[model samples]
Target: MTPEDRFPGPEHPDSGPRHQPDLDVLPYGTYYEPEPAGYAEAAYGSETYSGYGGARYLEQHWPATGQAHNVHDQQAAHPGYEPTLPDRPSPVHQGDDPPTIELGPPLAEPVPAYPYPAPGPDEPVGPLYVVGDVHGYLEELRAELRHQGLIDADGHWAAGRSRIWFLGDFTDRGPDGIGVIDLVMQLAAEAAAAGGYCRALMGNHELLFLGAARYGDEPVQSTAGTASFLAAWRLNGGQQHDLDRLEAHHISWLSRLPAIALEDGHLLLHSDTTAYLEYGESIPDVNDAVHDLLADEGVDEWWDCFRRFTKRFAFRGDAGPQAVHELLDAYGGSRVVHGHSPIPYLTGTVHADDGAPPHIPGPYIYADDLAVAMDGGVTMEGRLLVARLPI
Candidate 1:
């Protein structure tokens, strides 16, 4: 299969062969040379995943209105490494649900929320804010938060009593991925202190990075062939700095992040895939199942979680609305608010020549408005999306 098959961006689920346009943009939906056991990844066969998959940190800012940037070439040189790691585990069937999970955080008890004055019964609830896939662009995130008045000039939580959720994929592709995670961690604590809450949903890149870190060089079964987590991570834009800076706190926080979230009537998620339906019928069941899988030490189990969640665009084409209904039926929500798939891809505005996006860069509500796409393509001449909810 061509890269188009691997990352069919915004096409019909039953799409037949069409003339492949811009092989350069082949899988614009979202690679790296694998290195030894350290920072970079090893290459699998020629099954090209989208270059936009991993971390993409650049010293320069993402082009404000330039054409969608393409990864011109793979930078890291392949280096030989010790391959004496454990033999591959048998590929487990990619299932709808991960191993069944008991509810709650991996920790013994949930962190107690500090009490604040309860709003009088009639007081209006605060605004709800949602951020799209940050992709490790920390300063861009800061600027957007500041613009939204979610943070103060000093980058502290200034939005009080409001709920802000980050549709995940905090690390990878951008500089200071760990910095973004650190900031989010700090914000969650501060937001709670200020009577607001800052939360996140796990994205595919999160699973990809975590797998690379925890089970580097350990081979897992892939539909294509034998694949290793470390190599795939590197190919997907794993930055050495982010991996190096990963701390126990980051892992603990990310692991605790729910795979599915329902906020203010929107079913918040990372990717636009129906694979979430595979986890469980309800929100809590899905979240707990995700945490349980991440907590388990099994590499194949983790691979299943990573591989499945990475699937995207389940809510597009003719069956899109029905897919949305299925999710809404199982999980209570009027809409599915998501990131992972960029808005540019949805509107076919990617890689425009003049750098001007096809549509105004904001949320692209489609699938009969049953779904909302928030990734304004900030990583690719797109704006950092800081959208208010109840649309």
Candidate 2:
């Protein structure tokens, strides 16, 4: 697709608004919100595939990756780049407040009086929750997580031993992305202390934000001819404030994040793609490879990681099931849970039947139940999904 095609507008004719796009930074990215008439197959991309369940085939190239280095090595190489994370991390400079983000409603599902069956004398307690994309919508995240009883009244981790995994995109687009990252970093420490853990999976946005901060406007060879990391990031809603506040610790944290994870027999990833296999045969190797790439200063290597990762919908069409099976077969997981491409994009509804932007009642299960999508379209006025795992 052409740049205009990827981000189409009415004046552009080729694209129409399909869903109220969930963008981290508001307004720059979305162009298609489907009218009552819906859309033709080719309009979405070079694809053809249907929705979940019995497929007429609504083709979904699909979801799209990062690089080299230890922090000490990076600091030595860059000169004058000292990033010692403060005990309390805060990067938003005073007087540089970002624009207010209008976060949407919280994602809620009917809960039983008790979340799980009461444990027998021998039963050990278990509660696993996965949060979808939080593109700098910190308050929304805090409110939504609190509702799930994960955090306490003071916004501290309170879920004792339950696991909470955040599927990346913690910064950029919306205001206070750094704040969100700070909270997660803090919670990870807190959660670990409580015998539970709050871990994160890396998302493409994390890659984009890092790239823009490091490379910014430097031309890189891409599948779509010459493009700069900065242009692509800003076009996709990279906020100036986030970029300004972007720090060494944030960069290091993002670089170290694993692209793939496993929990409760489910394969957790930030995007629904088979790209992880290219990094390594195993999860540890993949994370290591990405870390190495981030630490390195090569522009092309960074761009390659960024470009390869921008791909999405790999597991969505006639070949989607096989694609999923391949990832599972290689990764050793029965299911794939991911965030990146929002569900509204696949279903093509910005608004519900009631004229409200449709909220995902739950993670979208597709690819013959091999995958679950957690991005609830929070950036688009949809619910910010925080659902328990194995659903």
Candidate 3:
């Protein structure tokens, strides 16, 4: 079967062959080496799962825009394949009836309105704010940032000295992932020009995205059934438009993001897993280890790294507080702030039987008040959170 037959375009049934762009002219396309012999047969031989059948959120046929979406020449090699934006379902309306939730006993101590003592006149750093997972909800992100007075109406940094740290998962599962990254990159520059700074952590999706871009359809060993980086990405809400629009700069910026950070006594990370321990014991050591691993071209190592980051829910059971302490003891933080497992899932509130979206008011402080869950599950009709620390 042809590459086109395996990964068809929006108009697969009626589309005719189109012009292929010159690979040498596209910098991003260099990452797309041709698939190995019989790769299409080995990877996606069955007609049932050849295309978008196994994936969620991705439409069978997305309407095409006139612009060229296949910046990756590897996609261009497939004569009929053309990238398009995902047409995800709309979020549930706010007024809809919410599902029944079993309430647990209230926490022994409520989250303090003011956890930290007010800074005196001589304080050096500005107020610190951390953003939750932004899985391609660019507009929602903009609105929330504006609401927080971080950015102005024009989307420029308006907060003069207040720092912002984005807990990652910047791409995938929604529309305009590239646009979101572009905004963040732009904001980082803008924020630096001012007194403050904007930064991000490396999420699991970041690993998946990098793996898919660098390795493409190459086979990877998996505990699950047959898998490759590309297939796994698709199954886990990878957007065609994001991949198609990925540029060299975006790749560089994402690859260099730190896997973990410490800010204002908060241990900031992307996922809720302790897999980070495997990389390094110290903060710099961990980030350095992650960056070094990605710098190499070994596909199996990349896949393994991606898998390790994907583990979650470590801070969610009777041993949850102990789990939080494990990270704190190594990382030197009073509390852990994260954004991978959403609040709904952590609270057992994922299913909204009454047709309403899962309600996530703000950051969830749990794991014996040692960990903070910032992911509001934007991909699942929940909020995209941006919060101040010590909440």
Q: Quick one: best lDDT, which candidate?
A: 3
Please report the TM-score between candidate 3 and the true structure: 0.71
- Of 1 and 3, the candidate ahead on lDDT is 3
Candidate 3 Cα errors over 4 Å, as ranges: 1-123
Clashes of each: 21, 38, 0
For candidate 2, lDDT tens digit of each residue in 181-295? 9999988887766666799988878888888777766677765567666656654555566766768887888888888888889889987667777889887888889888889
Each candidate: what lDDT? 0.63, 0.61, 0.66
Ranking by lDDT: 3, 1, 2
TM-score of each: 0.71, 0.69, 0.71
Alpha-carbon error at 311 in model 3, in Å?
0.7
Give the runs in model 2 whose Cα sits over 4 Å from its true position. Answer: 1-125, 351-355
lDDT of 2 at 177: 85
Which regions of candidate 1 are displaced past 4 Å?
1-124, 355-360
lDDT, candidate 1, 1-391, per-residue tens: 1111121123232211221122122121110111123211121122212223221222122111122113222223223321121222232233452222211111232223333454455645567888888877787788768656677677787766778899988876666799999899889988777667899999888898888778876768766566667666665556777777788888888888988988778989888778877778789989988888887659988887776777666666556677778788999889998888766555555444564433323566677668888876656545557777765
TM-score of 2: 0.69
Residue 163's lDDT in candidate 1: 81
User: Which of candidates 1 and 2 is the stronger one according to TM-score?
Assistant: 1
Tens digits of per-residue lDDT for model 3 on 1-391?
1111112112121101221222112111001111233432343332412222211123333222232334332332222333433222233233644332212112223222212233355646657888988888787788778656677768887766668999999987767889999999998987666656899999878888888888777767665444567666665667778888889999999999999999989999888778788889999999999999999758878877776676566776565677778889999989999988766556655555674566565677666678888887777666677776556
